[model samples]
Target chain A: MREAYHDQLGELAEQLASMCGMVGDAMELATKALLDTDLAVAERVISDDAKIDDARARTEEDAYSLLALQAPVATDLRTVLSVIHAAESIERMGDLALHVAKAARRRHPQPVLPEAVRGYFAEMGRIAVDLARKAEQVIRTQDIDLARVLDDEDDAMDDLHRHLFSVIMAKDWEHGVPAAVDITLLGRFYERFGDHAVSVAKRTVFVVTGKMPGYSSDATDL
Target chain B: MREAYHDQLGELAEQLASMCGMVGDAMELATKALLDTDLAVAERVISDDAKIDDARARTEEDAYSLLALQAPVATDLRTVLSVIHAAESIERMGDLALHVAKAARRRHPQPVLPEAVRGYFAEMGRIAVDLARKAEQVIRTQDIDLARVLDDEDDAMDDLHRHLFSVIMAKDWEHGVPAAVDITLLGRFYERFGDHAVSVAKRTVFVVTGKMPGYSSDATDL
Candidate 1:
């Protein structure tokens, strides 16, 4: 019985790592849909977000059952609790991906991003996908060093977010108000995706080190 | 010992309710700062966000201790878990309010919103604060009926968000791209604030009903 209970706890971590992969795929496809104007791919991303939500629900239920039935204590208790926190952060990453895909769908054939600003988003998308992948590896390995690396990547994402704003506010910006609005929101979605990815890494660190990082919140305004 | 354990659980609920109030006040002050262009008020909101973050950390620590030392099971376990989840949602609410204050600060003295769309934001701010206040009441009372009312309030917020977009996208909109970008992000911050508030209510309902609502995710793209 004890062996099975421990297995369940390990399985919850595996589930969260898998969730990271799911959202990474969603973000990759969503970025493609945005840049390529592929409505079908965008639609697929939008619909598939449900699966991520379901994954979170299942992980939470498993963790809750572990807490209730197994009555895990000490390190085991922290593991169960961290699963719940990590699951919420990963689920939010999926939602950010969904927002990206929906942005692609909103403008359809016209292209959501103007040509001048498209490269910024492409780079942002690359960094976002890489962050999600790294977060998955961090969850699976519990490597604090790798988890800390996510913080640097998040810095890169913030730089890109700030650069995008400079482009919008530049005198050469000819996309007008609507396109600028789209770009602003798209930039925010990617920035927040990075934040949540860092947050997932932070939660993993908490489970391993038994101490939360000094900064609890990951939010910042552009 | 059992009675003390129950009191700790009750205190967790009270802590969450107080968190709701903290964020509610933050949102109110943020709105005031944005509308009035009061840098001092925006500065206060920005600084006070630390208090909300501290509240979340304390609540989570308390909940974690309950899970570790007391090893709460069944309803008590659920209550503890829900405290973790609800605290996260409330913290995000505080972050959203912080975003609003930051937006106001970023464009200090110049006002983030132009004369044309200020009314829309004014209304959005009002609804966001009301939703936060109602969410606090729901957390305290565990009143599912009051919780359901949050959904209606969220719908109202969505309407205001959409209306703000319409005004920004109107043909006569002369606020230019920078202002449009600011309005877009500000609108999104309030919309997300409403989503998190409703999420808090849903978690309260889950603690009472032993079931999560059908709609697991509250995110949607404009």
Candidate 2:
């Protein structure tokens, strides 16, 4: 029974890694769609979200099944629950990517980002993909150290978000209200994408350390 | 042992309902602070979030302890896990409220929402409280009917969110880039608060119906 349970856990981990990869690809494609104004790429990202959703659903079902069948305790219990948590974070990341794609698609051949802030969006996209990839590695290996390092990456995204705001608010700002609205929402999407990756990484750390963050830590603080 | 486990589940439900109330109050106060430029109220909202976090932590710990001690299966397992899920959604609502508070604080004395848009924000705040109250009742009563109705409430929020974007994008929009940015983020925070409430309600529906939402259903669609 124990061997069978461990096998199920191994399967869960594989599903998790796959989810991370799918989310990473979704964000990357969504970014490409935004930067290149490629409707096909944006369509792909929107259509591909179903796969990420399915992956998350499968992971959750497996976790619930394991809990019911194996009734695993202590670290094992935490592992199953953490898998659910991480999958949820990754799913939200996929959703954020989809939002970016929708924004790109909404603009169609016209660029979603203003020319002045495209560079900031590009850097945000790059950081988001990097964090998603790192989240995958952390999940695959359960590397607490790598998971901890995601905080710094998330901080970088925050910095970029702040920079985007500064550009919009600059004295020489040329973009009108519509462009500012797009930039604001796009920056938020990218920032939240990074946030969900950090959330997954933090839960990975919790699963390994068995220490939940204290009440003092804000949800986004993770 | 079964009776004791059932009692624990009942206690968990109470904690979740209380959390709903706390988060609802936080958002209400945060909205007031934002609209009124009341710093003291904003500070209270920020400080009170710790209580919501603590409640969530305690509920999770109890759920974990129940799973380990009782090894609940089938319905019992789903019930405990749903409690945890509802608590998590409520915790996130609290975090969104905290973000609203911080936004209010960041702009101190200067209102976050411009005078022209204050009415729209007021409506959003009113709807948020209404949804939170309904979520609490759903948790307490486990009313699948009530749970299903949250979707419509959530839709109302989405409409408000769309209206906010239109307002921001209107050619007549006079708010500068900074105000626009703040309004955009604030609208998102309120929309997300409604989203989380709907999530909790959907889980409640799932627990009662033993059915999951179809893949085509959007997250906000719930």
Candidate 3:
């Protein structure tokens, strides 16, 4: 029975890793769609989101079943809980990508981003993908050091977001309200995607160390 | 021992309701600060958010403790899960309110909403308060009917969001990029606040009926 429970736990980790891959793919494709103004790619990203949501729902059900039947305690319980949190975070990332895709679709035939801000978005997209990839690695390996730096990695995205704001708020800014709105929302979507990626990493750290990030030094091990 | 667990569950419900109340108050005050350009109120909203975060953390600790010690099953388990989800949704609502406050603070001494869009924000604020209040009541009463109708209530907020977009996209719009960015972010904050409220209500409904809001008739009850 114990072996079965451990096996299920392994399966849970695999599911989360799979979700990370899917979300990473979604973000990459969505960013491409945004940068290229490709309606087909954007539509694909939007439609592909259902797979991510379904994966989350299934993982959550697995978690609920494990909690009910196995009644995991201590680190086992935290592992399961962290898996659930990670799944949810990944799903939110998928949703953010979907939002980006929708924004791209909305501005089809005309790129949503003005040329001046496109490089910033390209860098933001690169940072988001890097974060998602690192998030996947942390979940799979439970590397505390990797998890520790995920937040610092997120700072790059934040700086990019702030830079995007400066571009929009520049005195010589020429884009009207519609383009400004698109740029602002796009910046936010990328920044928040980074946040959820960091959250997944932090939750993994909590599972391994039994210490929540930014909390007290005390470990709340069960 | 069973009675003690039941009591803990009751306390969890109360904590969630309290969070709902605090979040509603935060939304109201933040909107007031934004509309009136009141720096003091904005600061208050920003400072008060920590209290809400502490409350949610305490409530979540209580939940983790209960799950660890009590090993609840079936409907009891579902109830605990719902409480946790509600707490998270309410916390996100508080964060949304915080964003509004921050936006107001960023634009301080200058009103964030242009005159033409103020009415839409006013109505959005009212809807947010109403939804938060209803969310509190639903948690307190477990009123399935009330929970079911919360999504419909969200429609009004969505309509207001769309109307605000129309105002932003109007051909004669005079607001510069900064104002447009502020309005776009502000509108999204309110819209997402409404979404989280509806999610809390939907989770409540699921707790009551063992049915997900949009899922098929398959009953996954334990």
Candidate 4:
């Protein structure tokens, strides 16, 4: 009973990791859609929402079955519960990516943001994909150390976020109303996207360490 | 053992409900700030983020400790996890409230949205408060019927959201771009706030039903 339970539980774990992998891929596509003004990619991400929704359901079911049948105790039970909660977090991340994708669609042929500021978004996209991939690695290998490093990556994205904001604010006064609104909304969404990735990282730490945040509880000190 | 667990878990449930109540209050003040151009209220919501963050943390710790201590099964386990998850969602709702607050701060007092449209935001706020209150009542009484009704409230919010967009698009084409961007972002954040409230309602269903959305088997949807 124990072995069979562990096997199904492991299967659930692998499924979650793969879901992370898909979000990583989706993030890549989202950024590419932004850069290339590719409607196809944006549409794909939009349609993929149902897919993420489905994964969430399955993980919840798997978690339930494991608990009901195996009746695990102590640390093992915490681990299972953590993974289930973590799955929900990742689903939200995917949902946010789709929101970004929809934003991309709304912004057809993509007006160019200031070049210096554009670099910040590029860096944010990079950090996001890395965070997603790191989340996958953390789940598959249960690597706490790598998850800790993802912690710093969140800060880097945050810096980029602040930088983008200051630049946009400086431009807002000069560029008039339309520019101000665009920069504000764009920067806002980008900053929030970084927040979602950080959330995924936080959940990864929780799953591996049985702690809300592995090393630092205050990831949003900025 | 079961009785002792219930006592501990009951407190957690109350905290979860309290968190939602706080979010609902913040949302009400945020909409008032936006509609009335009350910078003070906007500033209040921004400063109130720490309170929301604290609520989220305290509620989360409560849920985690219950799971760590009680060894709850089936519905009980689901309830604990769902509350933990709902706290996170409620926190996000607070974040959206802050989003509107920031947008309000950026705008000058003059040139408010039309009366009919402002009514939509007001209605949205009331519905949000209602759904949140319903969820809280369900947690308090374990009334599945109340939870079920809140679940339906999500569809209502979706419909209202569509109306919001059309209203904005109509005014934009009709009134021209004068004050368009601010109104657009305001509408956007209001819709998002409603969406998060719907998410909390969905978790309430999870707590009661043990049915997690069941979207697809092969999709790995997340």
Candidate 5:
């Protein structure tokens, strides 16, 4: 019974790591769809979000079962609770990717991003995928060092987000208001993707270190 | 000891409901700050967000302690877990309000909304406050009917969000790209505020029914 309980806990971590991978793939494909205006890929990302949500539901149920059946205390209990928190954060990462894909689909056949601003989005997407991958690694390994790396990547994403804003607000912006609005929201989606990754990392840190890193303010701040 | 555990559970509900109230006050003041361009009010909202975060930390700590020390099973365990979930949703609502307040501060001395679209924001703010208040009531009462009302209120928020978009995207929109961008983000903040409120209500419903309401999709969709 003891060993099985530990196995259930390990399975929860595996489920969470899988979710991170799913969201990473979603963001990567959604970015490609946005840049290439591929309606098919965008649609795929939108449809795949359901799978992530299902995974979250399954993980939460498992965590609840573990708590009720095993009555884990101390670090074991914290681990179960953290799994629930991290699952929600990862599910939200999937939703952010869905938003990116929906943006791509909404302006199908016409690129959501302007020519000059495409590079910023490409970099942002790359960082977002990287953050998601690292988040997966952090969850799988409970590596505090890797989790800390998400913070730096999130900073890079934030810088790219600000740069994207500057470009949209520039006097010579010729794409006009509609495109600007799309870019503003798209940029926000990518930035928030990074934030949720950091949030997942923070939850992992809490489980491992027994102390929350930077608990005063979350990464979702505007 | 069981009585003490039940008391702790009741305290958790009270803490979460108070958090809902704090965020409700924050949104009301934030909307006032945004509409009036009141820097002081905006600044107050910004600073007060720390209090909400602090409340979350305390609530989570208490909940964690209860789980660790009490080792509650079945309904008791689910109640503790739901409190954790609702605290997160309420804290996020507070963050959304903080985002609104910051937007107001960023455009201080100049109104964030143009005169033409001020009515939309005023209504959005009113609805956001209303949602938060109802969320508080739902947490306190755990009334499924009241929880379901949040869904209709969320629908109202979505319609306003769409109408706000149409206004901004209108050909006669004279505010230009920058204002459009601000309004886009500000509009999104309020919409998400409503979404989180609905999320809180859903968690309460889950606690009452032992099943997640609308578990397939969340209210955060674009």
Candidate 6:
């Protein structure tokens, strides 16, 4: 029974890593579709959302079955709980991507954003994808080093967010408004994506160290 | 053991209801601050986020303890799961409210919306508060009647959102970009508040009925 339990746990973690990869790829595609005014890719991103929804449902089911069938405890329990939360966050991130894609489809052929705001969006997209990748990395390798770096990764996303706001509010404000709103929503999505990724890392921390991360209310502050 | 289990469940339900009430009040204050342009009240709303954060943490702790201690099954397990997800949606709704309150504070003496835009804002605000209150009703009563109608309630919010967008874009194109970016942000917040409130209602439906309201996802439609 113990061996079976370990095997099940290993399988679930691998599946979770794959889901993160797929969701991250979807987000990258959605971002490109938005920036390049690529209707075909925009349509493709939106059309392919079922992939995300299916993965999300499966992830939730895996966690539930692990809890009910295997009755995971201690580290295993943390993994399941964190999986549930992370799955929800990734699904929502997918939705955000789909949202941007639909908007892109609607406003086809629009010019790319002005430079300052464009930089913010690109940086946000990169950080979001990296955070998702790092989550999978920590999961596969159980790397304490990767877990420790998550906060710094999230901080960078936040810095980009604050800068996007400042640029919008500056003298070039009008130049940034449309791009700013788009960037703001993108930042919110990416920041939140980074946050959920951190939750996975913290769960790793807890599993490896038997300590819940600090902060009484650190849900998605991840 | 069963009686103690019942007692713990009751406590959890009560706490969830309390959290729901706070979220409802947060939505109320968000719109009220907008309508009145009361920066002090908005500041208060932002400052008081800790209360909502505390409630969220307590809800999670209670849910986790209930599951780990009681080892509930079937319907009981669903009940715990519902509480966990509801608290999550509530946390996000609080964050949405904070987003609006923060925007309001930034626009101290909030920029006056056009009369037409104000009317739309009022309509959106009313619908948001109504949906939030209905969430409380479902939590307290487990009223499937009320819970299912959330689709309709959300339709109203969606309608208001669509109407607001038309005005914003049309005015921008015709009259050349009038309202402050802050108002735009406020509108986005209210729209999102309604979305999360509907999410809470959907969770209620799952808890009570054991079915995940299978509204097929087109992702393109989002």
Worst 10 residues of 3 chain A by lDDT: A213-222
Q: Model 4 over residues A1-222: C-alpha lDDT tens digits?
A: 878977887888888888888777777887777667789998998888779879888988888778766767676777777777778777867766776677678767754354545676677888888888887887788777877787777778777766765664452434444444455455555555556556666666776677776343223311
Backbone collision count in every prediction? 0, 0, 0, 4, 0, 0
Question: How well does chain B match by TM-score in each candidate?
Answer: 0.96, 0.95, 0.94, 0.83, 0.96, 0.90
**Order of all candidates by lDDT, from best down to worst?**
5, 1, 3, 2, 6, 4
TM-score for all models, in order of appearance: 0.96, 0.95, 0.95, 0.75, 0.96, 0.89
Any idea what lDDT model 6 has? 0.72
Candidate 1 chain A minimal-lDDT segment of 10 residues: A213-222
lDDT of 2 by residue, A123-179 (tens): 999999999999889878989878767778788788888877888978789878788
Least accurate 10 contiguous residues by lDDT in model 4 chain B: B213-222
Which structure among the candidates has the greatest DockQ?
1
- Each candidate: what lDDT? 0.89, 0.85, 0.85, 0.69, 0.90, 0.72
Clashing pairs in 5: none
lDDT of 5 by residue, B1-222 (tens): 999998888899999999999999999999999999999999999999999999999999899999989988888888898899889888889899999999999888999899988999999999999999999999899899998888898888888998888898888999889899999999999998998898899988988899888633234445
lDDT of 3 by residue, B105-196 (tens): 98778788889899999999999999999989988998988976777778878878888887887888887778888888888888889988
Model 1 lDDT tens row, A17-135: 99999999999999999999999999999999999999998999888888888888777788788888889889989988998899899899879988898899999999999999999
Q: Per-residue lDDT for B27 in model 1?
A: 95
Q: What is the DockQ of candidate 4?
A: 0.20
Report the C-alpha lDDT of model 3 over A73-168, residue by residue, as the tens digit: 778877887787788889989989998999899878899998999999899999898889899999889898997677887887787788889889
Q: Which candidate, 4 or 5, would have the higher DockQ against the true structure? A: 5
- With a 3 Å backbone cut-off (N, CA, C), the pairs that clash in candidate 1 are none
Tens-digit per-residue lDDT, A51-99, candidate 6: 9889888878867876777666556666677777767766776777777
| Residue pairs clashing, model 3 | none
The regions of model 6 sitting more than 4 angstroms off are: A73-75, A112-116, A172-184, A214-222, B110-116, B172-180, B216-222
User: On a 0 to 1 TM-score scale, where does candidate 6 land against the true structure?
Assistant: 0.89
Off by over 4 Å in 5: A215-222, B215-221
Model 6, residue pairs in steric clash: none
